[model samples]
Target chain A: MNRSTGFAFIAPLLVLMVVAFNLPIIYMLGLAFWDKGRGFTLEHYEGLLEAPVYLRVLGNTLRISLIATIANVAIGYPLAHWMRGLGRRARLIAIALVVLPFWVSILVRTYAWIVVLGNGGLVNRSLQWLGLTDAPVQFLYNELGVTIGMANVLLPFLVLPLFAAMIRIDDRLLQAAASLGAPPRTIFWKVYFPLTLPALAAGTLLVFILCLGFYVTPAVLGGGRVPMISNLLDTLINQIPRWEQASAISTILLIVALVIFAGYRRLDRKASA
Target chain B: MTSTPWSRRLLAAAGIFGLVFLTVPLLIVIPMSFSPARALTFPPPGFSLRWYQALFGDPRWMEAMSTSTIVAVLSSVAALVLGSLAAYGLRRGSFAGRDWAEGNFMSPLIVPTIIVAIALYLSLAKVGLLGSFVGLVAAHTVLNVPLVMMVMGVAVRDFDLRIEQVAWSLGASWSYTVIKVMLPNLAPSVFAAWIFAFIGSFDEVIVTSFIAGKYETVPKKMFNELILEVNPTITAVATLLIAVTVLALAAVTLVLGRAGKLGQTLVER
Candidate 1:
């Protein structure tokens, strides 16, 4: 296609980006610098730095996201490897099942967890049923619930990339290794594992970034108790109506996401090279 | 593919068990929604259509459903048009900064939703668009465009443009060539993109919670209720949504399966 027409085709998307994606962010960046109470000032940033609550929330957000990301990667790798070993039909079934939760609404998924982990819900009842405990478990509305729900929602993000990497693996390499008297475990460690690193790295980055920004899962499952950055920002923007502090928090989140994204690209290039 | 020894067997067992872990919670919600009891208990005492009946009996649930459908429908359409054109350009059109352009388009997915939400909320407030249906639709459209673009770009790339060139040589206009020759081949992919966009818009809560206020989308309303009261009604909604999701996924999978590029086709495409 000619340059003019090609540019024309891309124009609508660029317009969309400018209006919806880029412009809002630019607007928010401006809001971050402005004080909601008075004229333009650095008070928002100062408050963010000085306030112990904001610092604690930021720490909690990072800790929770990190934990969830690690758990997802750990679980996703083994599952992806296992699925890769299955026959075509079984692999498809396995993947579809793994991804089934992806189709559920975020709200619904969190709600499902509430029912599963609530005081009067399944886990508590099951524990009692099995006579393992007399009392119901304190599962929901805590850090533990937040971690489980977030990890569950984001598992597919890890699995898809890891599974994709596994499929790209050449069977010949494994066969050659085996023929060279390498045991299955040895071949997996030396051959398959290294080859899958790029995807694992990619999946980890993707999940980490995603988990960091996850708001609803934490909010619903965290029960206003475990305040993540997103939840804090939500309160500022909605309840308190402090646009500047909210903007600052949001700006921090964006910066972290960008750093993670840049790291992902660097790792991806190294892996490919 | 030849199977391995014990490791393979172990991997298979682990994989199946993980699948059960992933799916059982969602599975439980379905039967729980059908239970005669109002409270959720595992191994549901008895199955009945009480919750389902309540869903239909209540006007608010129906209204929420309609509102969700409206938002999804409008956003998906906008995404389909804008995304396809952009994807077509980036794929077929040789241009400088094409990689940058594609990445820019998909950046919405990577950017923290809170950032997107805060920005949109502020921007909408400036333009007198806050709490407006149009604002919410616009946000969702922006959010969904990347997905549609990704899918359509794949479909367009795999498409043989030689046929379109031939049609053009036979005196067909560019639009006509695209419509008659290119579009039929692309119809399924386009439809799939539409479904994905629809699903994405419908299920979204984070961005919606920020953008949507008193003008409540179903998910947003459910979120409000969830924060205030943990009830079986949300379970009922979850059940209906899960059922729809299963059905929709089955349809999409069948289409992708028939296309013979089920897994990779979605991502790379």
Candidate 2:
């Protein structure tokens, strides 16, 4: 079989990707540099630095991502361990439970949180009924709600990789340690924990990068009062129609995410080495 | 050995708590959709089908659904063709720049979708493709083609080349060999790819906002409703979405569990 024939078959795909997929990204980077009105001004990039708002939002986005990553790790590690211990059928069911949310629309998942956390929602009614509070606690329209929502949406992401790593771990090692008189905690910390660090790193990298670019979750759950970088990008585009600024922020976002992801890749390589 | 009993119990409780945390909010939306008060309240004041009626009655929602379906169907088909073709081209042995192509092709999966959306918006606007139905299809194809490629890449790798060889030896034409021998083996994965691509396009809100000029996808409409207005009918729509999601995941699970186990077998090379 001629590999050239294979190239002929794939040429359309490569062309389509180069044109529609790759070109647009390169185009966006171009737009960031040369504005239509200003003829290649750094004003937009400068604005990002000069404006405290962008910096604050960037810092805050990083903070929230860290918090959510921590939450996911805390919840995901045990869930993965538990699923690893399950029988085959039970493990499949558990896998499905984790994947169902992944397959669902982000919009639908955010709506679900709204229903539960709304002022006239289950939590408020429960609090009121139990005489805990006379009023709704304002769960929605805040950072806490956004964190909870992000964690719920991202939990499966953390768990899946962790589960994969856990399942591949040899049980005999644990038994060996046990027979050698190592306690359960000691075995877990020394043997199991070190092995799963790679998965944890991968999951955190994914979830954190995703969190930084997240628009819908924070916007819907944050009630427009809280602004992440994406939320701020929306304002500049829709309300102010500042394409230059929008492009600038988006470019920064793209680069920051890529840089961090690249950094993680290097760290992962070094750690594995 | 599992663990100490105390640790085992603790992990089990955490596992249960995690599952509930992930699933309960999604389930709670079902009853809220039926709330007669047009607001989300616990133990809903009463149950009624008014929200569903409103959703079925609304032309705007219907239009959005129709648009999304048309866009999804068109893009998924396009993605399947383009992606599968690409997969068929690459053999197991590495080619020069295969690593670069592989990484770049899947870059769409990384690099924030918002960036993609914005970039596509700008480029399409330049060529006057903004908000055009064709633009939406093209943008969506870009989003889903990589997924299709990833899925079909596995199927192609696992495929028995000997079967394809027999067809060739029997003097089957190129198209006939592909249509008869190769495609049959690829059918399960093709279907799975189509569903994933369809769901991705259908549920896409961010990218649609950029190029879907004058068009409203169901998710984009739902976003507007979520942000600007509160409607009980949106709840009804969401419940229907949950039902669809259940069906979609079921199909995915079945396909993945079956023979070949395409996605389960291979990953990015």
**TM-score, structure 1 vs. true:** 0.95
- What residue pairs clash in candidate 2, if any at all? B131-B213
Q: Which lDDT value does model 2 have at B79?
A: 89
Over A1-273, each residue of candidate 1 has an lDDT whose tens digit, in order, gives: 688888899898798788888889998998888755686788779988898999999899889999999988777888888888778888867877877887788788788888889878888888998999998888888999999999888988888767877887889999999889887778888898999898789789989999888889888898899999888888998899988788888888899899999988777665545
Model 1 lDDT per residue over B134-250, tens place: 889989999999889878888888888787778978999989877888887787788778989999999888788887766667788899899988777777888778888888777
* CA lDDT for candidate 2: 0.82
Candidate 1: list runs displaced more than 4 Å: A35-41, A269-273, B1-10, B267-269
Per-residue alpha-carbon lDDT of candidate 2 for residues A95-180, written as tens digits (9 for 90 to 100):
77888888788988988888888887888888888999987898888899999899999898778867877777888988899999
lDDT of 1: 0.84
Residue-level error in angstroms, candidate 1, position A172: 2.1
The CAPRI-style docking tier of model 1 reads medium
Against the native complex, each candidate's DockQ, computed on alpha carbons, is 0.66, 0.67
